[model samples]
Target: MIESWRWYGDLDPISLSEVAQTGARGIVTALHEIPYGEVWPSDTIVARKAQVTEAGFDWLVVESLPVHEHIKRGDGDLSELFANYRQSMANLAANGVHTICYNFMPLLDWTRTDLEAPVAGGATCLRFEAVRMAAFEVHMLGRRAAEGDYSPDVLTKAAAWFQRASEADRDALLASIMAGMPGAFDRYDVAGLRVALAAYEGIDRDALRQNYKRFLDEVVPTAEDLGMRLCVHPDDPPRDILGLPRIVSDGDDLAWVLAAHDSPANGITLCSGSLGANPINDVPAIAAQVADRIHFAHLRNVTKDPDGSFEEAAHLEGDTDMVALVKVLLDEQSRRRAEGRADHTIPFRPDHGHHMLSDLGRDMIPGYPLIGRLRGLAELRGVISALSHG
Candidate 1:
């Protein structure tokens, strides 16, 4: 495994110099300044790569080159967008950046109910409470069909939760859900969210999957031709949210997409924290099964609740079997080495970390603080070293 760190260029409170100190040699980042559906020029890609190299880090992967909303919806002149995406892939490959991570989730990227939920160690971590999210979907967003999506018991509980939530609580939930993620272009207001949902009104799970297939059909060949690997990130939370269809949530969904474009160039970005939100996903098993097709990995853990809520837990302390997963990854690396594949060693980053120690109250990017992630990287590195040698 190649240890890496995600760096939000230019605006990241944590500098590249600081990232170098964490013992991570590879940098996972993107050309975030460019708007979605536009071309990432070769010069821009080279310039960013130069910055990483100058800082003594390899530009290992693009955490995302966002899939345009128009492409996801199959609406409004997709040819232009697809052409732009292909050109960007060409530019990235031309600059020796071959791995591209992207997602196909419609409307929003990842849905979380709280960005600063208090944890046991006096640190704050990202959390997703089903009841709070349900409250937003049913009472706040007021989606007409939102109630049908939840069970009777869930709906009742959500109603009660909403009733008891003060204005500040409700406001916090709204901000957390609506806030834009790094490299995303789909941030929304209440009306904007409703309108975004309306775009996918007639599209269900099957239709959305088909749309993604169409995208792969158009883009995968270009990626292969450019010697670029495209990795699709799993849907965060791994379930339906606000009635939006979630096509890449579990192993079955992963198999569906992999079969859609059976090529080494078309792969998956295995995110343990995202998939582990749903208790049904066995993180280690999935990693072993998808080892051949995994181009990147996001290693983090979560403590799941029976009611479909979860909080980000320390890397080694959550429901995920971190040791088993690392063992599988090591085995996969060995397998790749035996086969003499150039990209045998997968690039992985400590996904999201708690805002603790020096990170507290720093106005940093949510879920991305310096001290917490360094701690995670150190822990993961220790485990990898111990297992690899033992």
Candidate 2:
């Protein structure tokens, strides 16, 4: 496994030089400048690679090249859109960027109800509160019959939560819930958000899965032809939310995807933090089973909730046994090497870290504070080294 950190390009508050100093050699990032449907030009790829390399880090992973909404819906001009995606991957591979990490979550990126949920050690971690999201869906955004998405018990609970919230609290909850999740909030107003959620109400999980297959069917072969690897990130929270159907959540879901497309280019980004939010997932088993096709890994953990809520946990302290997971990857790599396989080493980046120590005041991406991640990478580095030697 190669040590890496997720670095949002140019716009990130943490500089590339700072990332290099964290003892990580690879930097995972994306071209945030390119719009969703546009091709990432070769020149753009070179410029960002130059930026990171000059600052003493290798540009090893592409955190995302967002799947366009049109492609997701199988709507408006999908052939052209998929072509653009293929071109983007070709551009990346041509520049020596082989691994790509992306997600197929609908309507939103990952959701967080509170950006500053305080842990016992005075570190602020990102949290997912089901009630708060329900409040936004039912009361703040005023989606029609949003209660139907929840069970009878959750509906009653969310009603009480909505009644209890004051005006300011409701506004803050809405802001936290809907700031930038694809077409919902970034471009739409309150009404448009409601309309967007309503559109997905009828698209059940099975139907959504079909749409995803349609996407992969067109895109994966092109990727294989380009010699690029596409590692699809698992859905965050790993369940349906805001009426959007979540397809990539559990072991069965991933198994179905692998069965559907038997291609190396169509692989997975095994994110422990995201998948571990569901206690049911046996993390190491999943990794080791699919290790041959697993191209990228996002290593982190979470403290899960019964109500589908969760918070980021310390690297070694969460529900996930990260040390054992790392050993699994190492074992898989060793097996591959013995078999004389090429591209045996998998790319891994420390997923989300807490806001700890003096980082509380600094403006950075939620759960991406420096001190905590630096601490985590250092711990993981020692764990792997000791295990290998012993």
Candidate 3:
């Protein structure tokens, strides 16, 4: 496996020099400054690559080249957007960055109700609580159909939670749920969220899947031609949220996607944290099932509750069997090597670590603190070493 780190470009608080110290040679990043639906100028790609190289590291993967909303919703004539996406792929490939990771989650990226949920050892981690999300949807956002989406028990809990939540609490909850990621340009207010939700009113699971398939049909060929791999990230919570359909959630969804466009370029980013949020997903089994198609991996874990709430756990501490999953991925790498495949090794990163040690009190991205992720990387590296030699 090729160990990698996700850097949010120049503005990231964690510097490349710092990343090098973590012993990860591959940098997984994106041109976040580029807006969605725009062509990534070749010069910009070269400049970014220069930055990574100058820091003595290689830009091994594009964490995302975002898919525009128009493409996902099948709205209007997206020919221009498709053209731009293909051009971006070509530009990336032209610069020797072949592996691209992206997601089709509508409106928002990965979300959490609490960005600083308290965990043991006085560290904080990201969490998604069902009642809190329901509170935000029904009581705060006041989505008319929100009540029908959640179970009666959840609704009751949400109502209770909403009643007890103070003004500051409500505001934080709304911000936490609606705010864009670290470098995102757009942030949604209540009205904006409602408008976004309305846009997807008629698009259900099947329609969304078809839209995704359409996107693959358009972009995967370009990737194949460019010798690039386009890996779709699974839904963060691995389930439907805010009345939106999540097609890439489980093993069956993965199977459907692989079959939708059968090509080595059309692949999956095996995110254990996201899939592990749903108790039903066997992370190790899914790893083995999609071993050949997994172009990249996010090795993080989460502790789940029966009521559909979960918190990011330490890489090796959560419900996922990290050692077992690593063993499966390593075995697959060996098989690919024996088969003489050039892209035999998988690139993986330790994702969403807790804010511990020097990471606390730092104004870093929610789950991407320096010390926390360093610890995770060290732990994962240790596992890989033990498994390989054992």
Candidate 4:
């Protein structure tokens, strides 16, 4: 696989030289300065590519060219937004960017309740405790029918978690959940937050699935025409959150997505942390089954607790078998090479590392501190090297 790291460009506290030092040859980034739904001009693409190339790294993939809000609703100027997205993909291809990774999660992007949950090794990491999340929904934000999303036991746990939270903790929890807002519900006010959560009251898993299908129908053809691979990243926690449905969690979901578009261009990003967050996901099997359409990868892990709580783990630790999963990707790469594909290796980045070492005290984005991801990239590179040699 092409070793890469996710860079937020110049705005990221972690510099490009630091990323180059991490042993990654490629960068996954987007021009975040541009507003969503606007066309990413060819000049901007060229300039961004030049920036990464100047830093001694290739632009591996567009971490996202965001799916616009109108497109999500399939109304209110959606055609224009979709046209802009298509033009952006075409512009990206012309500028030598090939793989485009995106997500269809409504409202927030991959969300979590706690950005610094304590782990045993003295390093705190990003976490998604179902109880903390439910507490926010039921007690803090008060989303109607939020109780239906959790089982009785989980609800009990959430109630207990809320009871124990200090006022500061609850406030921080809200901030963490709303951090780096993405998709339909960014910039929500207090009343807007209520309406936003309430809006999902009747949209079940199947309805969200239909919306995703609608999205792919518009973009996948353009992606195919321009030789771009469209990879949909799975839901971060691999489950429903705050009464919202998650569509890209399991095999069945993937099957439906692939069948919906019926094109190789519409594929999966195959994020290990996202899928492995659910204990039921057979990681190796999941990768193998989706190998043909696996255009990008995000390699990371978490220590899953039975109480529906989990904290991010180092790349080599946690329940995910890093080597076994890499082996699956490697085999897929080898097979593709054998068939004379243009790009054999699946593009991957070491995702969501701990904020540790010198990065521990830095008030950077949660799970994106430099030294921590540097360590993760090194670990993943070592595992891949060993597996390739073995």
Top-scoring candidate (TM-score): 3
Highest lDDT scorer: 3
Q: Estimate each model's TM-score.
A: 0.97, 0.94, 0.98, 0.95
Q: lDDT of each model, Cα atoms only?
A: 0.88, 0.82, 0.91, 0.84
- Tell me the lDDT of model 3 at 312: 95
Instruction: List, in order, the clash count of every candidate structure.
Output: 0, 0, 0, 0
In candidate 3, stretches whose alpha carbon ends up further than 4 angstroms from where it belongs are 180-183
TM-score, structure 4 vs. true: 0.95
lDDT (tens digit, per residue) of candidate 1 on 1-390: 999999989968889988888999999999888899899999889899999999998999997898887888888679999999999999998889999999998777888889999988789999988888888998999985877766778889999998999998888888998764435455666788787778787888888888899999999999989888999999987988888889999999999889999999999998999989888899899988888899899999999988888998999999999989989889998999999987789899998999998789687888888888888988999999999999
lDDT of 1: 0.88
Sorted on TM-score, best first, the list reads 3, 1, 4, 2
Q: What lDDT does candidate 2 reach at residue 106?
A: 84
Q: What residue pairs are clashing in model 2?
A: none
Candidate 3, after superposition: displacement of residue 305 in Å? 0.4
- C-alpha lDDT (0 to 100) for residue 244 of candidate 1: 81
lDDT of 3 by residue, 1-390 (tens): 999999999769899988999999899999998889999999999999999999988898998999988888999999999999999999999999999999988877788999899998899999999999999989888876878877899999999999998999988988888654424787777788788788998999999999999999999999988899999999988888898889889999999999999999999999999999988999999989998999999999999998889999999999999999999999999999999998899999999899998789788977899998999999999999999999
lDDT of 2 at 113: 87
* Number of the candidate with higher lDDT, 3 or 4: 3
lDDT pick, better of 1 and 2: 1
